[model samples]
Target: MREPSMPVRENAAEQLEERQSDRAYSKPVVVLDLLWDLAFVAAATAVLLSSRDEDPSMPLRLWIVGYALQCLLHMVCVCVEYRRRHNQVQGEVMEDGSGSGSGSGRSSSSSS
Candidate 1:
């Protein structure tokens, strides 16, 4: 008795390529992500502990506000990074698509 062979539902080569591209982020971005992680933890800790007015210089309200602002800034940074990488990948894809000179560039422009 023999089992039937099956074709791959997902492309292994594309998955590998995507993984490689994902790992190709610059060192600074990775460092920034780590710093953001630390900042988040610190901000959360500060917000949690500052409910009792541990710091006399700043009020708990100010700490909460600062934490909220930090969260907004983090969101903005994430959005900017995502847009930057998305554009980079789109540009690369466009270049590759246009390599054959089949007027695909015109279609992209017209679609935009």
Candidate 2:
């Protein structure tokens, strides 16, 4: 039987460096992701609430308030997450977004 040749091993530092490029999310992409998440929440709430046959008006009103609150909360969270990333990524000596910083660059405290 013939022996198989060994594959070349990649350097750990090189792999890490290579992975660092373009790691931050784009502004539009992040907004789109949050929008899709919000959309999912809205769709699920609508489907579940609508499935019940009685008193759509009151529940609909309640759902609107709840949905608005949920969307607000989601936006806050996404913004916080992005801000944290911005701070950490900015602190990093490696690459940065340069011309493209997202969501105000408000410099909030980071916890991890």
Candidate 3:
């Protein structure tokens, strides 16, 4: 004999609710991303301004160093943001799972 069917509609509703809750925190993440981009832009501007001066051979070396440093900083920022976003997503999934499990447990205990 087949087992009783699970409440698919209720499960879908719960998932939708969890996704809505997760989206509430998206604004801060977006703001952080924008801030990083702004910082990179500022670094590029500084490099350009400093290199524009006529300082014989030193300015060229300085410009090269500045460009390399800027590239490194930008890469680091991207990696950090990527890791932070990944962690946030994992945390949300864990929280959602725990919430659903506890809710189901409560419902089951109440009916017994």
In order, the Cα lDDT scores of the candidates are 0.60, 0.58, 0.60
Candidate 3 residue lDDT tens string, 14-51? 66775565454465665575576667667777767776
lDDT (Cα, tens digit) per residue for candidate 2, span 1-112? 2233222233344445434533445467678978887786777677667776775555665666677677778778877877776666566523335635422232222212
RMSD, candidate 2, Å? 9.8
List the lowest-lDDT window of 10 residues for candidate 1: 1-10
lDDT of 2 at 18: 37
lDDT of 1 by residue, 1-112 (tens): 2333223323445456555655655546656775776688677767676566454665666666677667667757765776676676577567877557524443444346
Comparing 1 and 2 by lDDT, which wins?
A: 1
**Quick one: ranking by TM-score, best first?**
2, 1, 3
Top candidate by TM-score: 2
Give the runs in model 3 whose Cα sits over 4 Å from its true position: 1-58, 98-112
Pairs that collide, model 3: none
User: Which TM-score value belongs to model 1?
Assistant: 0.40
